[model samples]
Target: MNAPQTPGQSLLEVVDLAVDYQLKGISLPAIRDVSFDLRAGEAVALVGESGSGKTTTAMAVAGLLSPNAAVTAGGVRYRGRRLPIDDDDAMRPHRWNDLSVVFQGAMNALNPVQRVSKQIAEPCMLKLGMTRDEATARASELLELVGISAERGAAFPHELSGGMRQRVMIAMALACNPSVVIGDEPTTALDVITQAQILKLLTKLRRELNLALILITHDLSVVAESCDRVMIMYAGRVVEDGTVADIFNNPKHPYTKLLIDSIPDPSTGKRISRPIPGDPPTLQNPLSGCAFRSRCPSAMSICARDLPELGAHEQGRVACHLYPAPAEARGFHQMGEVTNIMALENLQVHFPGRGGMLSNLFGRPAAHVRAIDGVDLTVRRGEILAVVGESGSGKSTVGRVITKLVQPTGGKLVFDGKDMTSVEGLALRPYRHRVQMIFQDAYQALNPRHTIFDIVAEGVRSLHLVSGHEAIMQRVAKSLAAAGLNPPQDFFARFPHELSGGQRQRVVIAGALAVEPELIVADEPVSMLDVSIRAQILQVLIGLRTQRNMALLFITHDLPVAWSIADRIAVMYLGRIVEIGSADDITFNPKHPYTVALRDATPKVRPMINADPLPGLNGEVPSAARIPTGCRFHPRCPLAMDRCRQEEPPVVDVGPHHQSACWLASTSQHS
Candidate 1:
């Protein structure tokens, strides 16, 4: 490791760093001309899309690049001493002793069979040269420091939740008290409340340890709240570098400005989604001027002929032709008439829990998992209704019931004056033609071996929507174009792997559109996309609603996203609707404490210094099989009272078309 860090000194500096990956004997540029500096107690965020070089740059700095990656130019220096980042053996001594990395996927990064405590202790014993007993004690302390109990450390990775597994990773990263810690999308897969907790923990740790941090993530909201400095990357280069306030307040680069604008901001009223026009440039090609010229709205002739170098502009640095020359700076369409198209009346779906011969012999009762309990909802034509909640809250399960994927154990589903309560098998084919579902993961939902054309044509062919080959091709092309893939022919022959995360999602949307469904059940559609691409996808869905007069049952864990596009919002807690109202009322003037906590947990695109703790929940959601009586959410509710523990609250109408199921709803009404 380098010399001990001095107070208020530069902890790490990377100068003109470049990295290349060997793909089939061809060198592909992953990072080009990246430079940054971090002080002893500073936090910098690398923000961009999937192929934008944020993760690669962070990996290079942490001396943890992949096997095929090579540092072609420049180097990383720690405390004024050069680090052999390219040489794995030479970098070992300094890897965890000075710099550590918390990878993105906690499940994949951790060893499944090993106990979490043993995994955390490995680094301590190996790097610090501590005995087994000392390392074991240190592991317990680290777990406690990360807000996880020491007793839980004895559990295996599979036994923990997503947030707990991530906490274990964080504990492991801080095993040796490293000078710098790099978090690569640490909270990407977590819920809003859990995300807030992790961000809060990292902030607290940074303050206590006085360690510099480099966070690599595409979520600008997270960057706004946690980062001191921001580095915007695009197409293998740093396009903008500045303080958080400078970047968010007055972004100079067109790309940076567009990225900030593309975010789904519920605070703004009735804004339409406008995605960046085109795709990012392919880095494999040699000829290029400005990489963002094709998609930039302010692009001039000079931008196509010459590249803009990173230079000082006002309070920040930006690589844009407009900076040196001049400075200039997802909601559905409302329908004229709205009518109820679908309604759920006291819907309940109870799945039988696992039971075997051994369990029967032991006199164990086979309980049912209450996936959905007493849900009453309605979806209007040409209007979007969003169901928002955490995992296991049954938001997705509600969508499944409406789409007829899962049979409801009890209750009624009325659609277009037809009762679909007990519809199943071949009898449900007609209903399926009018209603379709878009799943969360596009990769898993689609067949990898099939071409884009074949995948889109499958629904059309199966439903007998088109007759001949030529008619089917035309139908597929129309759907693809409607989903925003221009010309459509270019992607027809390509497989799922050939497309980016955003493009793959569009294909899934196209498949859904090919059937020409009047009502679409989208479950976490844009949850996997970058902010820029997410805008495009949301626009496509919203556009469909206007053109086809379609009704959307959007299910997601993101309240802000739902607020941006939905006409109505429903908050779910423990398989029950806790609150329901217009989007504005639900977000701005919530009657339920759960809704209030969720809104507070979401990180905003505003500056906050060592921010105060969020008013989120204190514990995880209870198991469905063993749900608490009285109020299902009472155990984790901050405003719980004696009545809340003894009797379940009845749904009360707080306003016109607004209802809340809380004991204090009567007093909390805005009136």
Candidate 2:
């Protein structure tokens, strides 16, 4: 086997790097013998699941490890010179001038009190020995270079949008004209369109400045779209390294294959996807052999006894017992049909905007924000209904309204043949127990001070569904086990803060299950989770839905996810259901222009060198306060006609159980 070679002189080389964190007197390995290189003007991506040490490796290279971490072995060299990264005083001079990092969550990284201009100028004043005025002027120029207006440099971080704030972070990273930049999950919480814009900007800047880039992220699509080379990490080890084409088209390692297959692609219709079973090994415990052997489908007896060295396989390098051996293809689960359990007819939820005192006194009514204006949808037992749309499309609002968290201004909500729109007190209590909600942000949803057992038991006890302490405990344990938190005793006493993001979400689901609800409304349940964990959570949801015959209302903005797990899909735009049909019909034969545009905007796993830019919508989502006249989506629709702008379109049946609200749907067949 051969080691990976660089085409040009190595700009940054990490040789046999190992790092450990000290807690009390115990040392825990966070990164182990990881080696990679970045060439001048090249972009490399580190891809892996959560706790895979991608961030730790980037931090080690950038000399930004926390206080308790120590570099036990190896070194990081820049341009043939080993850097004294551990020594702050020695590395200070070369920090921002030679290398800089755009940290995750730009809003949290920037100072709220200081203006953005000053924040970007700090590196110029300290490292370049520029006067304050000159540094400020340079900061303005940097802002302009990153696509932000120089006049907005005086604004605070809070005043900028999420995408703009990230651009500011990039401008700061390039403040001193650094030759290398490291971006850690730079597009973590951004929408698909904004994410495309950011990736485009990064690619343009890298080419113009000839800068070396290291991007650390769990999104494989992003890596495929923007990176030249790819490195797969797992349990603190670099399992595979190769060009994007080599890795994505023909992976060698089992873990690498699983990671690639786990991604749900809308371009392809409903490919079979299965989450990799089991959790990553805890770094605190030492293992004799491969850390991923327990989860590897192709694991052999020798895998548990001997550790495999990363060696050349095909055109890339891989570390696995079955390196050259082909992996077995896995089958997908098939969903069955069921009867409708809940239905919404002409749901309307409008909120009045604020009006001036003079207008209010004069008898003018405040304008209404049509959050969910006249939308019809349905959920079936043992079925997954995925409602997908961009931000401000009222996807989450529909979920909230279904859960009774927000009352509808005018609509009929039929659950179990009973109208729940005006139900209250005892009537509402029974309905609440029948329906449950799983929020997007698990950390915020779960009580920090409560134990896992108590959090799950709160609903059971409050509803008085069961009697006695032992009975409650039994129910809690059963629910926990159902949600995949096995050996409930181990997690019963743990707090929300002690669990990982995926674990916390499972806990939330367990709480919802404790009450034995027939319907579960999960709003963006796994958006913030890593790819592997996201797959696991989706599997859990599907498993529970089948085992218990419960209905799932999965609300998300990711179209591929909807295609992967949904029985039916409803694409929303400006408070209306623009399209509704089976997952296959919605993905493969989309009728509306809005749905087609969304499908095109989604990023898929492809080679970055010749990949085309996403044909994203032209303008931002129209505000609900003043939605566009006629078809609300006409402003951004590529196929919009004059009639679409002047007259609202009615729902037309395009196929069996398929409907689209577009003017052209009646006369033409769109992609």
Model 2 misplaced regions, further than 4 Å? 1-338, 356-363, 607-615, 669-671
**Model 1 alpha-carbon drift over 4 Å, by segment:** 1-337, 355-360, 607-614, 667-671
Alpha-carbon TM-score of each model against the true structure: 0.50, 0.50
The digit string of per-residue lDDT tens for model 2 on 1-671 reads 11233446577878667788988755678887677888877999999999999999999888889999988766788877888878777877767888899988998999999999999999899888899999999999999999999999999999999999999999999988877899999998898888888999999998887888999998788978799999999999889999999998998889999998888876777477768899998877645468899999999986775556676667877888786322210011122223478999999999988777987899888789999999998887656899999999999999988999999999888898888888767768888789999999999999999999999999999899999998898889878977878778789999999999999999999999999999999999999999988977887786676446578999999988888778789999999999999887787678888888777777877432222333567789988988999889989876788998999999999998899999999665444
| Alpha carbon lDDT at 470, candidate 1 | 84
lDDT of 1 by residue, 206-241 (tens): 878888899999978887878799999999888999
Cα-based lDDT at residue 664, candidate 1? 91
How many clashes in each structure?
Answer: 0, 0
Clashing pairs in 2: none
